[model samples]
Target: MAERDDLSRGLWAVVRAMWSEIGPAGKAVLVALAMSAVVALVLGVAIPKQVERHLIDAEIRKLSRIVGAMADAGVIPTGPAQADELNALDEAVRLNLLGSDTVRVKVWLVDGTILYSDEPALVGAKYSLSEERIDAFNGINSVDIPNLSLRENEFERGFPPLRELYVPVADDSGSIEAVFEVYHLAEPIETTVGNIQQLVWASISVGIGSLAIFTASLILVYGRSIANRRRLAEKLFGELVRSQAEERTRIIGSLHDDIGQTLYRIHYGIEDLRSRVDADNPVAGELAHIGELVNEVDGSLRAELRSLQYGTGEELALGSALDELAEVTEMETNLSVSVHVETDCELSPPTRIALYRAAREAMTNVRKHSLATTVEVRVQRQGDQVRLQVLDDGVGIIDDEGLGLTTTRERLEAIGGGLKVKPDRRGGTQFSAWVPASECEVET
Candidate 1:
């Protein structure tokens, strides 16, 4: 945790140092999508329109060639004969139109009268009475219809979109004889463009969806990894705290039990030696007893320090820490004391020491300042947390500057713990500390 915070702070400091700014991720996504849409539109519209234009132009040229071929061969009879006399042009038109689904060919005489047409009515009657037919009849070999807005001949048909090319075919005597025109329906080209657009959009959508899924997965994975690291760090810190407490307890026990006992033995030997040598060595015996008394006092001090810091690094049963506190308060103070512990989760060594200190401070304050008769303690495990309380039926400290209570709060917070103190329901004060159960467990 310490390293992570430091790294993060340094990186952010560098970013701030550079005065760099970043756009929002949402805007970036939108811009990327919009660019994709533009590309899709180009592919969908431009390519197909170019293809349809090439195909329509080719049809027009082919129709012109067949009409010229018939005019060259004189296969179209000079005057009306059997319908079969038109066979050469008819055959040419049918063959060319058959090869293309888009082309429709028709033939009309010089008077705007249809001679033969793919449409039955045009074969015998006048055409649409449009200027397209008039121009073709007046020796215009190539009269292309302009689009609707130009106040000119309609470019193509109504429902199917229209494009027409009129080619005049002259007789041997040079009189205008007929017009051969090819019509192309634009609707199919438009429909083809629409399909292309749908396909392009589908591809772009799929690509974006894939990118989103991949990015989301990456973020989720990183978040989960960070969470696991935090949990492990907390666990390690708990273990380190418990280990330090255990080591301290071991050292204190050694000074009190082993070193103190050896010193006492040497003191007794010296006292006996002095008594034997100088007879009536009252001071010597007295000095030996004083030395023993000093050792005893030292032992008591060792025990007190051990109680504050001792541990086996195991989960410390709540009853044990509270029992010791209750005993000390009852024996030293006039206040009647009671302690109750109901918990299934035990606290680790550091937490136990913290709780013991808090409870001890509260009771000590009660003894020194509170003119109260009764003190009550309750420790309970609520869900994942262990809660400890010390209450006194005495005059309670009103100010926040009370040294002991302030220290208790600070200690709890140091371990990611919580502490609170309030007036008891019956009269006096209540002090409480709560910490997580996982922190209490040593190896387990």
Candidate 2:
């Protein structure tokens, strides 16, 4: 039972995967096929059976009219002279109406006696009338295949399969005088029914096939349109990321060249003034304070420049870059940080920048909002993909940290990567990111 349950689960999983891939139109096609199959089966069975029944019934009615005329004329065998008349009637029928299609003919009395039969041995034989034959005596006709298992059909073994008809012959008083039993060669009726069945099913097949082809074509066109939209979205996103990166580079260059050099000049002038001024002068103390402020601002600008320089350096592998990032996060946050690097793949500049910035922003958020004791950053490469996770044991995020997370996610997605932030089991925030490693060459 357990094995069966497991098998069932696996089967359902496969079904869900297939359904997800095929889209809504494909699902509709599946439903259409099932419905069409049922419709075809119902029509295939009912139409052919109905056609054959009508054909056999018309034959039974025609034969019954001839038998009724004979009974009204007292030509059906009730005595020796009528028996001779029945023989003469049979000769006329054989020359005119009875050919390859007629198998045998019999006239039965109301009391279940065979008054006249084409087969001489059956004449004057008393047999039990079937319930269906009794129904025929009440002025109804029935057509069916003969049941060979019945004792009455023992002599019928030498013949081919036959369709038997039981029809009533009524007199002027509306009382049934006799029952006409006609055995017909079923081949012609069966052949015609078979032909009709073939036509009906062939038309259904063509209709269903055309519908399926048309539906599939529409689905293909819809799928192509969706694919084109996705491609357009990705292209736009790529342009956005490129623009953002270029802007960051420009800002960093301005900060380092313009602001850093100006601060250095100011600090140097303050130092030269300090060397020339008296140690007890109040101006000397103010200059030293000013110099300290300048040095602090310069140090801050350098730190920001280092953070922005991720992925710009040609010598860095992704694993080594994340390791360096983890160390810096630990120094700034004063959190116990453990860094794990399991793979060494060299990524393209834009991809590496996306991953690196996402990691840096996550760590920064943890440092700013999470009042926790420890942080763990992991970087690993799996088949065709690389993953990075930053976890911090802190008070969980109670509110949304809007821009930091949203921008990080957008940047990652722009480069065909993803970011996820969730509360870990230990009530800490877990920031996870993954990107396709297939775009990167493995470092030797």
Candidate 3:
């Protein structure tokens, strides 16, 4: 049972993968082809059988009519016959019934005696009547392909498969007197059935071929439309990115020119006032403290400006960006930071941005939560994927992620990348992020 469940899940996963890979038009074509194949198979088997049955039924009816005409004309033998009577009966049988397709004929008495037969040696032979022959004595007409393996059918074995039919000959009182057994060639009916089946199969083939052509045309058109849409979306997304970068640059410039210069002037003014004041004056000490506060605020503002520049600027490589982040992190916290990045492939703008954000978020988490100091950041392109790892010698576990890390994770996931945080084997927290390195272009 477990194996069966696993097999079912495996098949389902394959189907889901196929479903995702094929677009809507391809899926429609696949379903149409499958349904058409089933239909053609059913008709291919069933139509031939139905046609053969109809042809055989017609042959049986014709045989019955021929036997009935002989009975009506008093040609069939009713009992034991003299030599002259047998000769007359044989003449009548040959003149009226014998043909290429009508190979043999026999008249049977109630006691299973061959009262009359075209085969001379079987004129007086006796055989046990089967249940079907007995039923014919009660006026039931039957038709079948005789099995030549039976002892009674030894003479007929030399012939090809023949249709065996039984027709009851009745007297004036409507009581059956003898049974007429007929053997007719089956080649005509078989030929007719074969021709009909060929025609049916040919028609099915043409229909399927036409459907395939139509489906191919539809797929081509749909594929072209999809490609066009993708190109348009990429163009729009590139424009949007450029516009956002320009807006961010504008904001950074405004803040630097307006707020930054004003704060700098305020700090300089405070320092000059402190220089002119008496050294032992209490007010001078207070002015010095105020200048220090202003300087700290200016430093924080400059750090924020650098961050904004990093996001908007396009000149820095991914490795350089991570190195700059590490330096800033080391400066702010009492931690030693090491960086290693080995990648030869160029990265897309979005991938570069996402990886940089992941590193920054991981560093922020380390600063806020982890206790120990030293940190190491590593980046490398492994096969098709580019991986980033930030290891800290701090505490090994984090109970929860802050909103910054969560947002970074979502951003990475949006670009077919992922982020994971776990405990390192060497007693530190490990932050890992990865994106497909082969996907060097943005996708809609």
Candidate 4:
């Protein structure tokens, strides 16, 4: 039972993986196909058998009617035959046998004595009545398949499958006088059944085929719609990214050319004013203090502008950006952090920004959550792809790191990149990301 449960779990896991690959619409198509196949199989087996049984029933009725007609005409032998009666019996059997399309015939009395048969040796033979034969004497007509599995069917052996009909013959008073057992050539009836079966299955086959085609068309329509939607999404995302970058560039340009130059002029003007004043004058002291404040403000402004430009993917290489971030993290967290640029390659603006953000986030996580000390950031160009890794000798991440990791993943995926976080062999977390360099342009 445990093994069975394990098997079931394994199967369910496979099903789940398959479901994920195909998604909701594909799963619906798969379900529809499975149901259709089951329905077709049931109808294929059931309809043929029902039709074959109806044909056999018709044959039984025809045999019963023929025997009834012979009985009414006084053609059936009633007793031991005299010379004239025997001659009459031979004539009756000879005429009726040809019209009946039967291989053999037996007319049996109620006590199980054969009164007349087409075969001379079977005539006057007394054999025990079979249960099926007894049923016929009681007015229940029966039909059976050709293979004789019963003792009373011994005579039916050695022949290809034949239809055996046991029918009761009634007198003028409506009493069953004897049972007429007829063995007819089954090939014709079987051929008719086979033809009908073919027609039924052909119709079913056409229906199933039409269903399959319809289902396929439906899946194709849905699949194409999904593809179009995905393409539209990617186009929109790319446009948004470009729009954001342009806007950021505009802002940074304004700050640098307008606000930045204005601050520099203010600082220089204060310096010149201080230089012209006397050292002993109270006004000179005031000017010097003002100049020192202006200088400090200018320095802060330049730093802010640099950060803004980096965030906008301008004026910063990926390796230089990561190296700056590592240095800042080391100062702030008192952790040993190192950055290495192992490849000489340029990347598109979006790729650069994405990888920079991923590395920065990983470093931040290491500082905030991981308690261990040493950290290393590495960047390399591998074929058509660029790879980034942040390795730290810190206690690995716990479950509650929250939306930072999720946001980083989304950012990477938006630019056709991926991220992975795994435990390093040295008991730290390794954060890795990669993107196709071909999808990016040379970093400006």
| Candidate 2 residue-wise lDDT, 71-141, digit = tens | 66665554333656767767755653456888777778878887766777887788899887898889888
Pairs that collide in candidate 4 are 348-441
Q: Which stretches of candidate 2 lie over 4 Å from their true place?
A: 1-120, 123-151, 164-184, 268-296, 311-444
Relative to the true structure, how large is the alpha-carbon lDDT of every model?
0.63, 0.75, 0.79, 0.75
Estimate the TM-score of every prediction. 0.39, 0.55, 0.57, 0.51
lDDT of 4 by residue, 122-223 (tens): 777887888778898788989876447754456768766777788888776777788888888788777877887888789988998888898777766775
Clash tally, candidates in order: 5, 0, 0, 1
| Model 1 ranges with Cα > 4 A deviation | 1-233, 257-259, 277-302, 305-315, 328-335, 346-357, 360-373, 381-385, 398-411, 414-416, 436-444
RMSD of 4: 11.1
| Ranked candidates (TM-score, high to low) | 3, 2, 4, 1
Q: Identify the runs in model 3 with alpha carbons over 4 angstroms from their true place.
A: 1-22, 68-96, 109-111, 130-143, 167-179, 246-250, 253-258, 267-444
Clashing residue pairs, candidate 1?
155-162, 156-162, 156-163, 157-162, 348-440
Better of 1 and 3 by lDDT: 3
Candidate 1 lDDT by residue in tens digits, 1-444? 977887785665444322211113433554665686677667666766676667666655776677778778766554443677666657756765543444566666665566776554445655454677677777764535445553222323343556667777777676777777666665565577668666766876787678667655654465455435534544665676667767777867787678767767766766666666554667766766676776777667666765545323134455775676677667666768888987655455566666766677777777877798988888876544578887887777567547777777776665546788788878888878876554332211
Residue-by-residue lDDT tens digits, candidate 3, 330-357:
7777989999996655777766766877
Question: lDDT score, residue 38, model 2?
Answer: 86
Write down the lDDT that model 2 would get.
Answer: 0.75
